[model samples]
Target: MNAPPDIATEAADHVRIVLVGTQHPGNIGSAARALKTMGLRRLVLVAPQKFPHADADAMAAGADDVLASALRVDTLAEAVADCRLVLGCTARSRRVQLRELRPRDAAAMAHAEAVAGGEVALVFGRERTGLDNAELQLCHAAVHIPANPDYSSLNLAAAVQVLSYELRLALLGAGGEMPVHAAALPAGAVPHAALEGFFAQLADTLEAIDFHKGRAPASAMRKLRRLFVRTGLDEKEIRLLRGILADAQRMARLARDAGRA
Candidate 1:
């Protein structure tokens, strides 16, 4: 059993580049380039003003892979559900009492947290409004790209690049293996076996109540696979969950025996 993505052991790969409600096409393009320069590939755009080969592609330069692989979603919740850790990139101070730091400091903190346990994510909001309080609440902390506090608003892509660059440096300088904060991450993605087992049990339970109809098990399982992958769970958390499920089965058996006796 491995540990889950906790406040620690989560690193750069776990970091996700999210653009919430972006307005300009060029910003999107530049952001993609920023991510590529930093060795980050995960990009999520929540209801951008425009996509599908905007001027962003031109700005992306040779790093179009970031744009090509961009995950476009209808909502912010959809973008971060499976993420183990969430961070907001903000220029202004947060109203609520959440941790906030300059970009360099925030990057270092996020990097340190990743070194400890699970995957981490740094989210950037739209161009004008930035991350609203509601959006910021989803984050464990807020990251600020230090600028002239007199005028510290950075473009969305610039923010992305700054943080990404920090993470890249942290990863390269990382000596040997990152300290194992949790059970070994379940080898990149969740094992098919685990997902299959969950599906089998879920399908059986659904059938017991006669719910499932035409949903293909394998196809249906794809959604679950994405769900698990998004969370970036380490082996330990998965085992704990399985253990709880197994105990429920054991209890059911005991109840059945008692009823018969």
Candidate 2:
């Protein structure tokens, strides 16, 4: 089970590029070109404002196949419904509390997930507004492109190209190895939705016990969510955590009943 994967083949089979709320047809086509250049063929378009236009085909250059085969969906959740790992690309100053990872790190992580026989997604938001806070929250973690501070407004296709390049580099590492920490990562890792559910239950358990004192419970919850994400909880770990939370909730209920009696 420790054999190195055929990086390109695995990436093509398990990794997907998700463009959410794309406003430009050219950008979509350019993103396809980027993915094709990096040997990644799967593309998913979510609620694009403009698509199937002449401009898109024209901009696709020689990579028209990627654009032609791209999957179109209505929402980001739909785009990544089957993916075990979803990494959203966002600017660094979004003020969203997420585990901020660089492009290289994110690429490596995505590649590792793909190698583990799990589907992975690299999500890019709109060209203008980028991913809103809500959309960002849906992702397992956020990738921050560390561009120059003076002018950080990266074009949609350009961002895609940059991340694609990083993914390719990560995949094309020496000796067919994808430079991953497979030993550290847990076995049978759960999907992003499971982690989200755990976070919700954790918050509920905390609230039941009056664990948060301040008026900003959401703030505390956000930090706790980031902490758990960084710790990399797998399916069994998540189940264990959920059991503890349930027990805490039951204990709290008993305490309340005793007080009433």
Candidate 3:
């Protein structure tokens, strides 16, 4: 007799494991195996150097179904565009200013978002370099695995396995209830794509209004991103913010026209 589907299993459906810029086909297969062992199935690959290879198949062992159904995308943005909650797995914090979460805490967040009907993604980076600053910027938070300081290096598959195990434990511990104090994404929270769109529009509006004031915009934009991402802006808030930007842009255009006259 099969076990009944529970909240954890259903929530797992909304969670995806994303691998970005993977260099090894074997790692992909191994990651798939790890995910399957923990009852996770969704896998998204972003710009893997080698995939659909014999070594990947061999490493996946009996988890061929996972490899077969894995999604391949050209960029990290595409992999997690629809996700409301995206957590990047990093060995260490980078220049990007993101809230850091331990694997267990990250798993709780993922479960909370999934339970709240939001898509969640746990992202891993390349084997050698890990996720770059630009890639890290796409993530809502960073998930750091605390290994021994003397030798903190972790294999790509191993990192995936760690996170997968944590997520599985979180799911099992929930016992069909949402994890307490897990900071669930609000039901109205916008998808990553929407937030990205708003950011682009905001940049354009800032330029229109000369917000940078003859200075470089990268630093300011980064700060702005950090501020907004931490707030977990929802659809209504995003719309409101974008509307304000539009007005600012219009006023800037009018000012420029009047000055010309």
Model 2: residues >4 Å from true position, as ranges? Answer: 1-7, 174-188, 210-214, 251-261
> Which ten contiguous residues of candidate 1 have the minimum total lDDT?
181-190
Model 2 accuracy (lDDT, Cα): 0.80
What is the Å distance of residue 203 in model 3 from its true position? Answer: 0.9
Selected candidate, larger TM-score, 1 vs 3: 3
Which residue runs does candidate 3 get wrong by more than 4 Å? Answer: 1-5, 174-188
lDDT for model 3, please: 0.87
TM-score of each: 0.61, 0.80, 0.93
Residue 41, model 1, lDDT = 78
Winning model by lDDT: 3
lDDT score of residue 24 within candidate 1: 90
Q: Is candidate 1 or candidate 2 better by lDDT?
A: 2
lDDT of 2 by residue, 155-217 (tens): 999999998888777666632443354324332267777777888899889888989865768
Off by over 4 Å in 1: 1-11, 112-117, 174-261
- Model 1: per-residue lDDT, tens digit, 62-109? 888878889899876677765556678886653544555655555555
Q: Per-residue lDDT for 92 in model 3? A: 69
C-alpha lDDT of all candidate models, in order: 0.65, 0.80, 0.87
